[model samples]
Target: MSTHALGSAKLVLAQNVVHIDPAPAVFEAMKEGWARQQSARFLRAASITPRLRLIERFGEFTGQYPWQWTPAEGEAFIAHLRGGAKPIQMSTARTYEVTIGLFIEYLMDSRYGWTEVCGERFGEGPQAVFHEGNSVLHTIEYEGDPRRRPLDYDEVQALFDAADARPAKIRGQGRKGVLAALRDAAVLKTIYAYGTRRTESSRVDLVDFRRNRKAPRFGNYGSLMVRFGKASKGAPAKRRTVLTVPEMDWVVGVLQEWLSEIRPHFAPGRHPALWVTERVGRLSPRSINEAFVNARQAAGLDEDLDLHCLRHSYITHLTEFGYPARFVQEQVGHSHASTTAIYMGVSNEYRNKLLEASMKARLGEDWE
Candidate 1:
């Protein structure tokens, strides 16, 4: 028997395996055993804790223990989730399937002895109900809202202008939020400049900025250290160094002004966070989102466009500016080139230009 089936002394699979008699108690033990297995594999609490909740919820829905779960129950549960006043996103539904699938995996692995244990106690064991036949397929590259796209160059300019205008209006009204207004503007711009997610933007620290030797003109603002890039399954936060490009050189001034002139006003002594609240704490992702929403509204941009569009805009603009797909992928901390491609919503002008260039190079001629 594999050690995975025979969980550690601290885990119920080993200690209280036989003692647990009631179905409810055994179900709890299964969760505890699974958590132990996840931790043993170096998974974080954030990953393991959620799985427990998901398992418990699934058990509640099926009105059965892990040993009693079947493919039918899992399918029914997912079907029920597929329809509602506010249905789950495709990504979300897929995540539910993956989670349940993994939980079932844990219980059926013969090495874990759960199959044997369940067969002896409950006369059955869990099986993966979310197999390819019943699960959501990963067909589309982008499963997000169709309306969400990269802001055009003009829209980006308008967004920054709107954000910049807020501080002036606040000062004119004798309001106290001028500093915060400036901060929010800077936050929004930085998110665009660095291709940062809201969480990545909020998690940035002052010390994270690095001077790229290749680009001395930008100084310490040349590269940004993203310590909280999105994590893959059962992984820690991904980290990457995003180097500044000439196309986004304008951001250097913005960062300098915020660091030297504006952020100091917050008096964030000993607080390392690049973006701080008035309380000297790191700003939350929600605050970063609100900053984008206010800027979007002020710019009179499309309602479907959200904070993520800024990141999309960054990826798209970089591609248009002739940056290599690999470079863009690295800058944005994406694991795969395909994932980066999903963000590239190139303009029609860019396509026409590319076609003209291709004709010139290949045919050595141009059409009228």
Candidate 2:
């Protein structure tokens, strides 16, 4: 009688097994849940694909189905990653842990019916494997690599000089990319002047530039209406208008020249993109990054300096230029003052200048 019962259980297992080789139905159901998220607009295809890949990788690492997974298995997988020859960074490990945790949560959710399906099929069900104790914490305020810190004032000047010289050098050689080089220079300057992210810079439209009442000299280039500011998860794009400051007012003439002379040469038609490409379309973020890379190399700057460094430099420079912390935060579209502080990489010289002025005011000329 016992032998017959064992045979019956084996037949049930075999029938239930569908692509995972152990339990294909569960995998199919999990995929359907992911598809539901996509349909609900909770995630874009670009975001969904990578997360699905991560789930599959976790499943392969555990060598078991999701229902059979445990906290021990999840811990072991993270340990394996840390012990690998090319171990992942803490941020990357945290992302992996979060993705796995979310997947497990999906399976355990009663609304999806994964729990009941697993319990009936395997006499077990999924549970949360990652918890607060084992997960990484946001301990540090500034987690970005030190190598990618903001450029100093001299370095910013050198980078801009290199960008400006590119068009001149190529034009002297009778090269065909003079217009492209000019576009790159203007793009970099606009990003720095406006403290815009690469995507924001790339997405700028001619009509986005508005007149500032206080800065009438800048005309239509007095402020920028950024329609594509960074958004929080599952939220629409945030919008902010970055006003042109007195110190960076030189950008007004640069933009004027680009709009009147250089940009017209691109023949962008009525596309309205501020930065036009050789193809007469809006500049892409990838091209913006490439432009920065080329300029950094030409300037003999640090290899770690990326296009985002330009924004960091802008934030730090504004702080040094006597702008209040709250003002800087608003200019960069950061929701918190702490976020703006993280972007600041102020120079020692500026700090010293501040100290000197403060000492003179407090000592009443007694401070030498």
Every model's TM-score = 0.91, 0.89
Q: Give candidate 2's error at residue 282 in angstroms.
A: 1.6
The sequence of per-residue lDDT tens digits that candidate 1 reaches over residues 76-137 is 88878878887778888898889888888887776667777677777776777888787889
- Candidate 1: minimum summed lDDT over ten consecutive residues — where? 1-10
Best lDDT among the predictions, by candidate number: 1
Predicted candidate 1: what Cα RMSD to the true structure?
Answer: 2.6
User: Candidate 2 clash total?
Assistant: 0
Decoy 1 TM-score against native: 0.91
Q: Please give the distance, in angstroms, between residue 46's alpha carbon in candidate 1 and its true position after superposition.
A: 1.1
Off by over 4 Å in 2: 1-22, 38-41, 80-86, 172-174
